[model samples]
Target: MKITPLALAITLICVLAVLAGTTAPAVASDAGGIVGGIFGALIGTVREGEARNDWQKVNREVKTCLSKRINVSIGQLVQKAIDPTDPRLRPYMQACEQQVAEANAQLQQERRIAGLRREQEEAAKEAAAVRNAHARAQKVARHRELIAKYGAKIASDIEARRVRIGMTKEATIAAIGKPNSREVVPPSNELWSYGTKRIAFTNGKVTYVGN
Candidate 1:
């Protein structure tokens, strides 16, 4: 059965009371007629669905052990003046206690694994963000270096994608990016074509620009 938070809380209180010498009859009366109270409070809300399911398993297993060994239904135990510390109940209590311990341990291990998974995912996201930031910073630094070398006006022209006569071959190339093709003008010039636009370079400087 699904255990609610309030039910678990009440069970925990009852367990405390039982441990403090509360009689079996009193426990049965207050916490319902459950043998060993299923130790529901021992696990105590470790997680939501899975944890409750584990507690429910413990409850059923303990009650089953009690019913089989004592030959009495859980409901009958509540009406009888059953002693919580009865010698006949010892072996079953020990076995049921082991089950509770195992359930708690399993829940703890699952919680640790989930925490590790979350940490790994967060670390990966942080690493990717750092890489992107570094790439952007490098781009900004490269832009500044180009502006310093070519002067602001030339840089502005490059930014506007304008190629003009008297601009250095390097500067013109920077403005328009790489050309589609380059041709050797027989004597000492270079002809660079950019799709429909063409530029003529003489002695490493642009001499003419045309479509």
Candidate 2:
């Protein structure tokens, strides 16, 4: 229901076509010796406007039909403009129709080229995504292999030390070594801490030992 720019432009073309048809003879007669020139100019203006309108309409129709899975040709639309009933307008119509054909051809060719470029870009992105996924999978596999090689022994050592709490700091230090770091916990009758080395004793026992 809304009148789009294309529709407005088409209306303008139709108005101009009627004006050119009615005024060409008058303008030609008034020009006298320059009648041919005036008529030529009028024909050229009408043809140009018609060609422009045809091109825009063809473009819109092409998009609509393609979206709906219907096929139509630009050339056929141009041919319809060349009405045999209006013999006086034949020359102008022919010229405008030729321009429409040329414009449509150029538009179609450009679209083809654009489609190919988009396809290439999408293919590249897909290839990169596959490569990234493969790389991540390889990394996960390597991590799992390393865990299988060392995780169980580490787990066993940690579990063994878990039960050996209640030793003095000196005794814990003697059994383990110097801790990489230490922290004090306040208020809870217990200092809970762990580090990368030695052992930490809280309330006279080894609470944490790390290697």
What's the TM-score of every candidate structure?
0.43, 0.32
> Across residues 18-62, which tens digit of lDDT does each residue of candidate 2 receive?
665677787535444353444555565565557546456544533
Name the weakest run of 10 consecutive residues (lDDT summed) in model 2: 61-70
Q: What tens digits encode model 1's per-residue C-alpha lDDT throughout 1-211?
A: 9987767766676676665565576655655534334545433333334433433454676767667766887555433434344577778778776876798799999999999999999999999999999999997886788789998788778878898778998898788888899999778899999999889999988999998
Off by over 4 Å in 1: 1-76, 81-106, 156-167, 172-181, 193-199, 206-211
For each candidate, the alpha-carbon lDDT, in order, equals 0.73, 0.54
Clashing pairs in 2: 166-204, 166-205, 167-204, 167-205
| Reference-based lDDT, residue 192, model 2 | 33
Q: How far does residue 41 in candidate 2 sit from its true spot (Å)?
A: 33
Write down the worst ten-residue block by lDDT for model 1: 42-51
CA error at residue 159 for candidate 1, angstroms:
5.8
